[model samples]
Target: MKTEPDAFSLEDLRQRGREPWEGIRNYQARNFLRGMRIGDGVFIYHSRVAAPGIVGTAEVVTTAYPDPTQFDPQSKYYDAASSLARPRWDLVDVAYRHTLAKPFPLERLRALPEFADSPLVRKGNRLSIVPITANQWDRVLQPAR
Candidate 1:
């Protein structure tokens, strides 16, 4: 998933071990989170940085559940229309796996023939969570391999 370095970094995730990935406001991205199953692989990407890229891997530790942030009025992600009984937002727990030896920069991935069609590279695609095929995953890690 793409996260701003200022918000959350790979090192932060490693230190925490696992954390609830909340604050997803997009319906499509929320659906992606809902589709996640335990043990699903995830690429932890850093966005809105000088060198945006995938810096590590993580595993889905929990299935989708109501996002507590949506119920808390003090949270920046809180939704006034959401209720505890029928939350409009959902989140999943992701556990740190490993940091890549070298981050695969977005520019480099865009240049690759295999990743040309990737949702991450698609114009105006801002979904924080995007599903990646096994082949695409392997191609992304080829540099580290």
Candidate 2:
């Protein structure tokens, strides 16, 4: 999932071990989070940085649940329309797996035929979470290995 380093970096995830993947306001991204099952693989991507790329991997430790931030008025992600009875946002718990041997820069990924169809390579595609096929996943980590 793509996150700005200023908000949460791969190093921060490693230190924390696990954390709730939260603050997703987009409906499409929220659906992606909801679809995640335990043990699902995630590419921890750093976006909006000088060298944006996938820097590590993480595993889904928990299935989707209500994002608590949506209920807290003080939170930036709080939704006035969201209620405890029916939350508008959902999140999953993710545990740090391992950092890639090298960051897979977006430029390189775009040039690879394996990822030519990836949403990440599409201009103006800003969904934080996107599904990757098994083949695509393997191709992405191959270079890092």
Candidate 3:
């Protein structure tokens, strides 16, 4: 999933070992979080940085649950309309897996034939979480091949 490196980097996840992937406000992104199952793989993407790209990998450690931040009034991600009885946001804990030997730059990702139809490479597609095919996942993990 995509995050600003300053807010939460791959290094932060590596240090923490695992953390709740939270603060998603968009309905589409929220749905993606809900759809995640334990052991699902995730690409740790750093966006809005000097060089935006996928840098690491992670795996879901927990099923989707209510995001506590959405219930807190002080949190930037808080939703006034959300209630504990029926939370509007959900999160899944992701554990650090591995950091890529070399960062897969966005420019290279866009040029890859495997990602030609991916939402991640599509212009104006800003969903933090996007579904990728198994082929695309393998390509990311073994880009040199």
lDDT of 1 by residue, 4-89 (tens): 97988989999999999989999999999999999999999999999988999999999999999999999999999999888999
Q: Candidate 3: how many backbone clashes?
A: 0
Q: What is the model-wide C-alpha lDDT for candidate 3? A: 0.92
Q: What lDDT would each prediction earn against the true structure?
A: 0.91, 0.92, 0.92
Pairs clashing in candidate 1? none
lDDT for model 1 comes to 0.91
TM-score of model 1 (CA atoms):
0.95
- lDDT by residue for model 3 (84-117), tens: 9999889899999999999998889999899999
Q: lDDT score, residue 94, model 3?
A: 97
Please identify model 3 stretches exceeding 4 Å from their true place. 143-145
User: Model 1 segments beyond 4 Å from truth?
Assistant: 143-145
Clashes of each: 0, 0, 0
Error of 1 at 44 (Å): 0.6
* TM-score-sorted candidate list, best first: 3, 2, 1
RMSD of 1: 1.2
